[model samples]
Target chain A: MTAVEERAGAAGADDYEARLQAFTGVELVPQRRGSDPVNVPMIRHWVEAMGETDPVHTDDDAARATGRSGPVAPASMAQAWVMRGYAASVAPAAGHSPFDDLAELLAEGGYTSVVATDSEFTFARELVPGDEVSVSEVLESISPEKRTGLGVGRFVTTVKTYRDAAGEVVATQRWRLLRFRPPGRGPEPRALRPRPAINRDNAFWFDAAREHRLVIQRCAACGTLRHPPGPVCAACGSLEQDTVEAAGRGAVHSFVVNHHPKHPAFDYPLVVAVVELTEGTRLITNLVGIAPEEVAIGLPVVLDWLDADPELSLPVFRPVAGKGT
Target chain B: MTAALRPAPASVAVGDELPELAIPLTRTLIVATAIASRDYQDVHHDPELAVQRGSKDVFMNILTTNGLVERFVRGWAGSAAVVEAIRIRLGAPNYPGDTMVLRGSVGAVDGRRVEVAVRGENSLGVHVTGTVTVRLPGGAA
Candidate 1:
């Protein structure tokens, strides 16, 4: 048989699409128990890795003061609790999971490349130490072949629900991914800028940027304002914090024109500047709407955004017309 | 000393080189850590799929890289030290059969806070390079 005939007989793209569609509403992971019970040590590790300072995740007294019984896990850590560590995940398992089957089918269809597109989560209750969590995932939807900048792919969405030992639902998450055929010769994969490491502390900042709002983190106790939100107040050491919308106004504090080590994702002679916000904080960002030579310290600038990728939106600074130093 | 114990902030000085930490990268480590971080991209766990995507093998996910960087800095800073911020940029991929060596030095010192300039290097080259700001105990008022 010819290659095309073999491929068609084995499993063509159309057959793969049909098979994938059949998986919608199918349970992928069924009642998978967490490798470890919710505890302070893992919470501590997560908070530290994410630069979170909220005391409730670590300090028992701080949690109690907030009217909780004790320290509670960060709501965003819902998935980490159920992670199958190196040993379990790599070891040969008993049965084939629906996710495995779906993945194999996609690979067979030449949609071997995959990337996570987005995830939405909702928390019903805070998890605490001793809470033995369990999770189950269901394939929600699978899109038809769509051409994207990356390649031709289908969007796969799944819903995972987390429950406590008593089977009480605590959190639910909608996860989406794109399974695509890697481009054979398409413009050397638009070099994707490295993804930002997001955790509980800084997630809200990115979320606000998605809506085109520039918000700054403020300590609820002493009212000191800070950028790049932290779990605790730097000045007052307060755990409680809030956010305030900025005017999106700032000025260039320092800058450097990068001329070498060109990354395909960015233009050459890139103007990278540190903008000093009117609120007295500094943010390192790209300076746009101006020439590299025009970039100068104290140059009055305003906030603009660079939709870096489908999933990333970064706040960039541009010189305010007729308001330069 | 174990990472659980706090190091005296007064004893740590600017320009002090932290003891290097070597972590062997295995296929399991690469894939498992990605799952732990809730990253399901096939390139991080499925080698066959990764090769099809142009990568020789599944690579380490960014979250796992960030987590390992945090672990390395905290291991040096001790349990009492609080990581205020960590900014990292990725370089070479950490494929299986490689050893990632984490090295750092105290970049700056300001009262309770010390900035650590860190880099994780593998056989291919730097896997990650970043700076971590940490607050050590006894120096805080």
Candidate 2:
């Protein structure tokens, strides 16, 4: 048999897995030291990108005004940091990450690894500057699937927890993948590992329970206000920054009308739009109240935040109150 | 986390074929995709998770997978391919350095609306197989 198909085949599964088992275990050995405290620029970038109009994530003084030590980035932003540790730990060896290698070895065990069928994250404390987090990763269990990708031998169910230096569980996430074994000798399917990592507003975006506002981080040096926060000022490359409120007035630079309803995150036939604020920066968002046939480039638009999720407000734009179709 | 995805074709049709496009699955491409979408689950990034999970390497998530499909149709058909509905079945995992063929063929031609069946595949297998509906820019033929 060829080398590619050698493993994952009945005869090959036993033979190849023997060599891989002792080698690719991704279970964390010792706790890892994480990167420095939450970078505001990075958090700012994420908040702005999401078009969240919550006060806490965007306003530092506002945050401090509300009893916070300082401006915190976000709670669920752990996603921005978790994989970096996995990537660093896996860098020297096969160049593949612990997560990536797991799928490969499991496939050798006679299964096909599927990407997250579902995911969700629970947050405890907010991540802020000066807060150092260390991650503890654990492989929870192994399972087998019956009817996917020739039937996969699902091997890994993992929990990656991010704790402050104090051991406080800032965020905890459990992950699952559908691993299918070979059709004839498929592993019996058990309770599917339910993924609990759905997307949600980060802590930074939910700083205050009583306010809503759009945040634009301004580079202290050049007065350059940018959204979807970042480290370097796009124009001057200076990292000095602070959050500022915007007038929410702009012209549509471009837009698209989506008809596909894939992720249950939202309904189908939605409007995705890009607008250029007076500052000359462009931001992406969903345009509400406008139908597919009425969108056009250079159209005037205004900001309207979603009111339901107090912690999170979606920035949706619409034709200027009295503007074009 | 991903900026409400980039602008899409303002309009599309029932069976308009967006010319096939190629997206190199580079390391940067893969990682950027995961980060952009805020997908923290391990299998998408941890190689060991990949090994333990039973596959060759980290696989792309449906979010990124769908984003790619969105990007492909938008880039090819421009403001003409308005994706009304995107139904995709995850086929296989795509690793870094792999070449993804973003191919879309016409599905149906109904009045001013159209749909294009699409996929993003590598030699290992097709990673994303789906269909998209868009309203052509200048209305339908």
Candidate 3:
């Protein structure tokens, strides 16, 4: 038998899969310090790279307009806060970790190369400037050896929990990696589209969608209702606001059929629409369950939930037939 | 925390030009900034991957462009100036081995609110064009 085959056979006989699975639920890395405090300079760099123009992340007045006291770091940046620089990765500190041990074991078994498969993030709150974040990683699961285009390998999944200086949980990430032998390469996978920029102003809106609830923010002072929840009421200029569950009914106010500059995360021709709710607020959302050509302005619609990725759930709109209301 | 450096609303006028600033782009700056922003897109940092994806090389991200625009406006508006709004649209990509020259002119002047028309150009052409509104000192909050 070939050397690789022999190693595979040996691994099987020794029940290496079970051995590796034992690491699940064990702490892999504890309390790794973030390279820097959440600051504006880094945030600026990020927004530039991502092409994000949200004023809440930069303009103080725009942030205050959304009811935030000041600037906020994008929730999608949770992992970036704790990234060890290239120098640290090249010359890591002399500390042994269960992560390193598992990698070594996988390498010994001819699964030396690795690539990130996907990541799932759950955020509890928006991170504001000056918050120092630390992270702890734990093994979540280890899959049995499976034959992939890259060769035989196992998927290693870990959960990273991020905490602020106050020890409040800010975000958690489920990171999965494929450890494989460096032969039999296949077609490259498409990268995920950048996640939505979530913060204190709109986090609750997203959270409510996960539970299949369509909610709109209402000014606690003047009873003005708004979608795309902001910090201040446009009419009353009140900072205090509350939420009201919607009847999930609306109509298409405007729309466009996207056919070019295609992003891998979505299918084209993608139907993007602006829907005006019965409550008089509007939202820019995707139109699903209907053909792009069938969509039109003033078409009555209803709310639907799109579990786009494992970690994200958003509200989409569907056309209503023979609408009277 | 200290005295404001912002020019008084009465002292500012329409068509006034803010001092220009030049930023040098390097691979480290590009990659480090992308990581800092929590952007892990290979096109922003991986030249080989970028080439495979049909880009000449790893290019600057829009977030960095927005941040730079904010920085330029804030630099001229002074420490006490509050940026009220910024609307920007991207054009050609800013790659390494080029310098982005940021220039701006006061578009309009209200009591305390000033609108600055700004553009950042690199060797390829215009990188970003936008307008920023800032509330200067002695202006209505």
Which is the leading candidate under lDDT? 1
List where candidate 3 sits over 4 angstroms from the true fold: A1-13, A184-325, B1-34, B37-141
- For each candidate in turn, the TM-score is 0.43, 0.36, 0.42
Q: Between prediction 2 and prediction 3, which has the larger DockQ?
A: 3
Report residue A104 deviation for candidate 2 (angstroms).
4.6
lDDT of 1 by residue, A1-325 (tens): 3323433443443455587789989999899888889999888777654544556668877666545688777555677888775555457456899878988887766777766554455567768999999999999998987887557878888888999999999878777777888888343324456788999999999998867788899999999999767899989899998899888899999999999998767778999888999998887888887988878889999997766555667888877884432
Q: Which model, 2 or 3, shows the larger TM-score?
A: 3
lDDT comparing candidate 3 with the true structure: 0.74
lDDT of 1 by residue, B1-141 (tens): 111233434477888998898988988778766765656667788888788786788888766766677677866775455555556666678899999999999999898888899999999988878787776766441
Among all windows of 10 consecutive residues in model 2 chain A, the one with the lowest summed lDDT is A189-198
Candidate 2, residues A110-145: lDDT per residue as tens digits? Answer: 565345543334556557777777776666665533
Best by TM-score: 1
Q: Tens-digit lDDT track for model 3 on A1-325?
A: 3324434554464576577877989999988879789888877777665444566666677666545688777555667788775555457656888878887887766676554554555567678889999999999888877777545678888889999998998877777777776554442222344588889999999888768788999999999998789999999899999999998899999999999998877779999999999999999999987888889899999987766544466788888763321
Q: Name model 2 segments beyond 4 Å from true.
A: A1-29, A85-104, A110-114, A149-155, A179-325, B1-33, B36-141
TM-score per model (chain B): 0.92, 0.79, 0.89
CAPRI grade, predicted model 1: incorrect
